[model samples]
Target chain A: MLDAVILTGLTLGAIVLGLLFIMALLSPLEALTWWAGWTSHAPSPGKLSEEVREEIEAQADRRREVGARPRFYLVYLTAIGGVSAEELSYRERVFLETLTEALPEAVIISDVYPFSVTNNPLTGERMLGWLWRKIHEKRKTITGGILATFIFARNLFNVAVSADPRYGPINNAGVAREIAKSLYRHDYPLAGDIPVVIMGWSGGGQIAVGVAPFLCLGLDAPIYVVSIGGVLTDDPGIAFVEHLWHLQGDKDHFHLISDILFPGRWPFIKNSAWNRFKRAGKMTVITPGPMSHTGKGDYFDSNAILPNGQTFVERTVEIIRDAVRTIQPPPPTSIEEELEELLGRGA
Target chain B: MLNNSLRSLMAISPELQHALLVLFLAILSLLFGNSVVLFANRVSRSQFIRSLLAFAFLFLLTFLFWTLSVQALSAMVFGVHKPFVDVFIIVSQSFTPFILGFLILLPHLGHYLYALLRVWVVINLIIHVAHAYDFGSAQALVVSLLGWLLLELATSLSFLKLDAVKRWFLKIATGKAEYRDPNDLVMAYVRAQRALMLQAAQQQEGRDA
Candidate 1:
């Protein structure tokens, strides 16, 4: 009886291992199929929630009232654990709000889902949405943590797809289109000459860098990336980024994976995109004191305080605000100026 | 019976037809290319039918040689003597991953994928060799390494110019291997898409005017 029980357990374990092995082998098919147009049948922007539509409308109204054209646009790409385009975690929402307050000249666009080329979020518009939702619900449990690796692995493959020379171009083009559509919806003119900032957190940073060149070409704008504890690759898109301001806490060692896995990031590979950008004086690496990569003292943690009495989130906002100020467009005509001009005409 | 089967096979869908062609070309390039070169003098190319027969014979000869090499190494290194037919079947089956050899033609990523498949073949060989001979994993690994070393020594001794063989295989697998930088293609594609979008917008403006 004991022998039979042992045999059954071993068989089950083997089957699970085989399935995982097969999954790893087939991970490249996602980008391959998207490039070949075999999948990604979801609509371009998918379904926008009522709240998102209302927010877009409010943004346009505010711009008109202020008599100011947004000097620049800030697009925030969420982390890999993000489940949807319209949804933002509480801390992420707070960070964006802080940015909006600090840099009122910049309009924030955060609806483009970076994990997918078609902007299809994991929990909506995808055929396997329910499966991801199931995994996300139990992600804190032991078995759930194990299952969550599948989601992370799938997104990691996307990062590789963007880094892959043969597939990066096609996938980046698709992602650029998604961002362009989001920008257009937010009253960004196709012919607008404003600079665009792509702010990515965690794995979103790699996707941000991967899509920069194509996004710039598509929108005809100067592109910059603000990476916050991002695991970045030595992608060719770095060449096209006008400036890249990468912020990390000294305790944040997650990015070392890129250094270990990608030979291009090695110091010996001096001609790599990362090294080239560094040499060109267009790259800035900022270490913002002691903090973890994601957990209690991560970049977005509002309660994590520094010696300077500022929260971690506040410091991140301050750094990004300074970066945006460097690239800010000439001040637009303010509402007060327009009103004063009308009063002078009346007098 | 053969004539009837040929008629049915020719009636397959276009997608199936393309798949079959891709499979045949991949097999021809991966399985038969090196073997044909090795047996060039022995293969009679007087007629199409004769050449076809020679191709099958060369494939079998290459298979026999591979089986013998693995069997000899296993016996010498681990004192395991699996049956000749069993070893032959295992080695031949290990080539299954090469069915996707057409992917090796992909521009930049293809080169890496092909290397990965080669690694996969080695791993497949190690697992099957250990199972078939009932040897420990370490013993099987040593035997595999010995076989690989022997092949390398033969190549280094000028049995075949490795570079020339690689160039020939690459040429057969991917004609002209033109390195297309993804950045250049993406820039061009994005420019084209932007132009189209602007054209559509202008058309809408004209209609409104």
Candidate 2:
């Protein structure tokens, strides 16, 4: 009886430890599921909490009353969200707050998804939700653990297989369409002519730029993109953007992987398309020396004194505001003139 | 199959001898995974008669920066009474493990292979440093590690365009020959941001009034 009890205790302890390990590994996935559920329920700014929605509406009304032309609709897309606005990653939260303070009249919509796992309209679950449910529902049995492991392995395989010709741009475009529809439905009464600016940090930057062409077509509005250390691809959607301001830190080695993988940014390539974009005054790339991949470093730190008297965070905030101001529509050119210019240019 | 083809080519052509030599060097450089040996040779030959020379020269220049950086750090830390040429030769030979770098060309296993190769190279470097300087294993390890740290800093600085070559590139690109100040770019970004914020605030205040 004593031996049996000891064996049972040891087995139970091992099982508990194993479960804890799995949970720790899948914590991000679990958080993603919760965020998906939250976002699915509140698809748009209108569906946000009554108090938050009312506050935004009141602000828009005030702006309208003041006859502010070209009302700005700013959408802040989070990267694989589990954290709320209050609990946003330090840099992300700082960026959102800075934007809010800079563009007081702008309607800022946060927590917009760039992709979903299920085709379900009401509960558009993300990849995390499927993984979370697989583990949570059958967690008591050994098969449950096996199933979770299988799912994780399968996801890894899928990621490896789909690395090239990435589906992110397509999925992000879909999210952009949804956002445009939401903005149109919500702000039609308050402001009809809305200039949609989509801002994303890191992977979210890929989504933000991906949404540009879709947002432009869906809303018929001028689109601006602010990418912060974004792992961007050479997507044709960039052509639709009025202005794209890319902020990178010199220390952000991870973000530079895109350039290595895609040689479009290579300086030796004559008539590089991105260079043309820069020359045309459509794209601006800024490398803030002291910033890190996650906006850590002197640029994001409040107490860090830069060579200039200003703090790094203050400098970053200034850059963000400048990027926002560069979102004006391109100067009008006649169709004949455009045709002549195009014909005049040689490949 | 590659070895067989190379053997057949060697039998067929006497005129292709120099070309074959260049090809061998190219392959050697690739196996070494850096430009140190290739660059030293290319610099000795002034004018490039072949395209391979140009390629080797570029790689050599790139590799020289890293090797030179390591040598400087090693000299500083170890206080080794060795000529720069001897230091360079040992340091170049230390990259023997990187011949396995080609394993990183394989998909899915690249990350693992590259990581393993890095460890192997570091171990080789420690051993080489110990042998070359007649230092104890522990002392060699300390010297190698400090030198590596400096090399890492140099590599990162190169990537950040703080290095002389990259700074020159920046000057050429911008058409503004400015001082190589690290904070210059950061300050510009900050200035733009401040101006934008000020403008926004002024506009907001004006509307309120």
Candidate 3:
């Protein structure tokens, strides 16, 4: 009887793992088909919150009035639990609010959904989108919570798509285009040498790195990534980033998933992009202390207090704000310089 | 000399790196007895030299047809002209992922796995073509889709009706011909197992009685 029970358990385990493996392999299809024009129309560049849009425009106006080029364009990509670019959880809203208040001079964008290459949120209109909406709604109940984990599954698969060299370049280009559109919508001067800062929390870290190379190519701007307890792989995109600041809470063991999953992250794999960046002094890892990966004690949790008498959210904002401040935007372009650039392009 | 060669390999363009990786995978797949080799071996009735030669010929033909079809379609539709050698390498190397084609033999998930492998091959083809030709993602997609469509129409209208062609395609596609209809085989196996279980239960009951 015990042997039979063991056999049944093992069979069930194998079936579940097999199904998940297939799901992972199939995950990049939507992004691939979208790029191939086989899927229904590509999602338009996602909409920004009107309030944030006005704030960004106000900053643009201020920069113009000062006759100074715009500084950093800070884009935040939320963790896997995010429902939409605009629909931030209360904790996430507070976190963004802190960043906005701390960096009034910089344009803050939180509307780009990192999980989907097309920026189509899980709750948005697509095939099986209604099912995702239902699952999200029931996320609080036990069974609903299990169903809602499919959101994580989808995002995790997207992370794989970004990391998989086979699909990464094509899919990341789509995502990079969306981000460029977002920056342009906020009045980013395409001609200016303004830096773009990507702040990725949790799984968003991997995506931010994955899309960095394409983003850099499209905009011809320096790219900086700030990962807050993010799970990152040794993606080739790391080579394109100007610098990376990774903030892991002491208690956030989940960030080590990349170390466990990616063989390239192993010590013996001496020449991975991650290691190259580290060797070049282009990556920094900071432990923010005491906070966990998510929920009550996550980086964005205002209730989580540190030994330094600051909230986790406060500490996160400070670290990111300082990182952004350290990056000096290029000096304003003189008329002669601008004319030279145009002439060069024309030639 | 090895260090210099390694440095040279590292210094090459990403497109070449990708092609080289795909070639490595193809060679590895062949070593592990890929479907094409297995099919040829089966046809040759365990004659190793004959099977190897036939496999090499089929692979060469496939490589030539795929590259030319894609190149012709791209030029006609998109007015893009890439070097024949570049397209040939990209097209042939894209087939490396079919090494995983054997996974299709799994019961219950076999057909889905087969479909996934085809999708993988298609995506790989599009990606490498785009990189090799410097085509935008959309253009690459159009080229790949049109190329496949043209090949499908040509092959179907030309050779698909032949019984030998059908048998050969089936053998190459499914890795092994013995389990051509895997689902039916699985169902039959299940039925046999159920009969044995019933027989054992009846005999136990008889002894108890």
Who wins the TM-score comparison? 1
Query: For model 2, what is the error of residue A293's alpha carbon versus the real structure, in angstroms, after optimal superposition?
Result: 1.1
Cα displacement (angstroms), candidate 1, residue A156, comes to: 1.9
Interface RMSD of 1: 16.6
Clashing pairs in 1: none
lDDT of 1 by residue, A266-300 (tens): 99899988888888999899997786887688888
lDDT of 1: 0.69
- Off-target runs (Cα >4 Å) in candidate 3 are A1-19, A40-69, A332-347, B1-99, B102-209
Model 2 clashing residue pairs (backbone): A318-B193, A318-B194, A319-B193
Fnat per predicted structure, each in turn: 0.21, 0.01, 0.00
Q: Report fnat, model 2.
A: 0.01
Candidate 2 residue spans exceeding 4 A from truth: A1-70, A80-87, A115-169, A185-193, A267-276, A298-300, A329-347, B1-209
The alpha-carbon lDDT assigned to residue A319 of candidate 1 equals 87
Docking class of 3: incorrect
> What's the lDDT for residue A271 in model 1?
92
- Candidate 2, residue A217: lDDT: 46
Alpha-carbon error at A13 in model 2, in Å? 24
Candidates in descending TM-score order: 1, 3, 2
Chain B TM-score for all candidates, comma-separated: 0.51, 0.47, 0.54
